[model samples]
Target chain A: MKQDGLTIPGLLVASLVGLILVAALLDGRGAHATPGEERLFLPDAKYLKPMLIGFHGVAADLLWIRTVQYVGTHVETDRKFPQLAKALNLATSLDPHFLEPYRFGGLYLLYLARQPQAAVSLLEKGAAANPGRWELPHDLGRYYYLEAHDYARSREWWERAATLPGRPDYLPRFVARLYAETDHRETALELWSEIYRTAQNDSVRSLALQEIERLKAGSSEGPLGL
Target chain B: MTVAAIALNTFREAVRDRILYAILIFALVMLAGSTILVTISVGGEVKIIKDLGLACISIFGTLIAIFLGIGLVSKEIERRTLYTIITKPIHRYQFILGKYLGLVLTLLVNVAVMALGLLGLAYLWEGVSSVRLFLAVLFIFLELMLVTALALLFSAFSSPTLSAIFTLSLFVAGHLSGDLRLFAARFGGAVTKLSAETLYFLLPNLSRLNFKDQAVHGFGVDGGSMGLSFLYAIFHIAALVLAAMAIFERRDFK
Candidate 1:
């Protein structure tokens, strides 16, 4: 009840009033438009590693979460990334054994950032560091098969990945179809059908069915019967 | 006989302190909470859980070591009980060592409890016993022991507040000593480089004891390094405890 500046309740009310006044003033001036994807100023991990006091794993995790958010922001905004590759490199360097940065970060680079070589390089680094992991090599195989269109490289990566435990059964099927089909359209159809057969959920199955139908349509002289 | 008696006494006193239980409970809670944090991670569930658990154990262990350790001597003096203890026929070095051992015993129990919790959680997460996590926890326990000795040495000669500050400063410096050497070599002249190297050699190179990255990453931590780290910790802790004993022996309880 007493209006003393040093008292707890007095200070609370004063702070609340001060905050409201600031907000009212800012509101009168109008809210500023959200800036374009802000700059990502990432220090080199070599220098940053020492400062983290051996907690670089969590630091890398937090940076990865931020990097994911960064990709999302760019995806929804200008669709241009000036710093994603650097962010991935730094995050991976901060904790080389963190597989997500290598696996999903590589995916983001390949598809979202549209830096195919950078994506390949990130996955290569991951595969080299984590030789036992299948995902990196598997993705590299997928990239070679789908994007690079290099059947030989895809088969090579897929072969190595298939040997590692936990690799999906789809790998050898991919390799078999790679060798069996001379026609690109037929290869695409078979790949989609395998994906449909092994699809984990309805959405994936639907996507695969669409791809199968589209490939069928592309190669078909008539729609009802080939 | 004297050291064991005093050590057991000191351990009993430390075990009774509320702060020890508080820190222990908080650490367990943090370990459990790591599961929730990992839900947002697209992958690395086991990793996030392991890393956070290890970090929680290391940090809370350090807090207990510092908070409880700085009071190991000064609190006795403050309560006017030091005069009674020193008046006994026991050598002051034995008392100091007893206190150090007691705190270390406390730390060992705390670290062990936390380590088991982490291993069980990790097992449930991945269904395999992570011996590597235990290795990391062992090194962390060694690090905490060294820190407790540092706190004892500081508390022997300084107030608890100053002891806490000095011990914490040394902990940070120890962790950064390797980086200091690197930075000095990269950016400094001959004198600076020499000074940095000397300090690096002088300070406890805690990174030498670090196998967390290796363990969590599935990197092979050789028995040689583990043995070396064990010896390194013993040497640092012995030196700190001896120095604290010497200082404590010279101090006038009156």
Candidate 2:
């Protein structure tokens, strides 16, 4: 420790001292300048790159975990997540493998954030990366089926998702039900009721409940005097 | 003959080591404690349980491998037991291979216990069982075998402290190797790039063994990829154990 030309600790300390001296010099130089009122959050891109990568991954993971939790809380309270859409997007953007960000995150964005376009874009990206994954397609189908009420489009998405690897055997049944929703609203209601009961996350359950109520209300209105 | 006998003897010796009990108890406790941990997670408590359970298994499994592995050969030599064993009827490779297999067997039993704890926690939290969770843990257990083999190789030639440190560094680097190469490509200098590239190929590339993420989301893990990874880890372990045997065979007890 005493005789080495530059031990690892000494080298690290010397570098720290040099950095402090330079920072002090920069501060001294900036002292003469007038303080400007105008300011934008334009951080130094060079330094920010590493920082962004570090924070983005951490934030993305944090947000994903929180979003999953929020899904449950939202369902229990029957609340819309109009604010969580961007956070969810930010998470998925940072970590594309985060499949839930596309499925349930899109759900929040569509129903809660009231951003169907963003939801569509999120699902599309998820579907592309995870083509063999069923969750994204199922959620995409949900967006069209319940939120958009475009049965034809919903059926298309569901059918495609149901064909993916590892999809539940019940997926085709759900697809068939989607097509029959117009004639059999009650069946849809019952299915959604089952989904709501079995739902792991609260937000999804709340969404299912909303759909059930809508279906019940619609059925009672007696099928638009066809 | 002496090498095989020593390795089997060491295996029997290590099974009686108290450190194994201490580590296994801690691991099982943590796995059991995951039930409480799950409640703190936001809404996806099952996901939380799985995450914590898998993490506990990996961490404790690595600890057992490292702690026991580092001493497997070094302790025998330190106690002057290797001199007796080495001058007798066994081959050096048999000793190394036997010791490795024995430690691996210990790891299997320990992992099974921890996995049972995980499965129990999952059952309690979600009221459902995941065969996939067990399969994921199985892969992780296999990965730890590679770590144990590497640790033993280092122990054969180095002091226990150095072996432990080297093995731990390898563990961290192995897990982060993919990310390291990506970072190097993006921003590293010439020397950093060369070293990163060299280490990429030289190391075991344990990230391939990671299916925890897939398990967490209930995503479909590629069976082909998993099979390839298992083979890679096995081959790597065999090569390390053989190298350790080569080193042990040449070293003079005097």
Stretches off by above 4 angstroms in model 1 are: A1-41, A69-83, A159-226, B183-194
Q: List the DockQ of the predictions in order.
A: 0.41, 0.08
Steric clash pairs (candidate 1): none
Give DockQ: model 2.
0.08
Give the CAPRI class of candidate 2.
incorrect
Q: Candidate 1's residue-wise lDDT over A27-93, tens digit each?
A: 7665354534377769988889888887888788778777776876677677788899999999899
| Candidate number with greatest lDDT | 1
| lDDT, residue B32, model 1 | 96
Give the fraction of reference interface contacts each candidate recovers: 0.57, 0.06
Error of 2 at B152 (Å): 1.8
Error of 1 at B98 (Å): 1.1
Question: Which residue pairs in model 2 clash with each other?
Answer: A71-A203, A72-A202, A75-A202, A75-A203, B1-B89, B1-B90, B1-B91, B2-B89, B2-B90, B3-B90
Ten-residue segment with the worst summed lDDT in candidate 1 chain A? Answer: A217-226
Write the residue-wise lDDT of candidate 2 on B1-254 in tens digits. Answer: 54455556666777798988999899878767756654533345566567767877888889999999998889888899878877776677777888888888788888998888888878876787887787789889988999999899999999999999999888877766777789889999999999989988888787788777677667777889988988888888888888898998888778
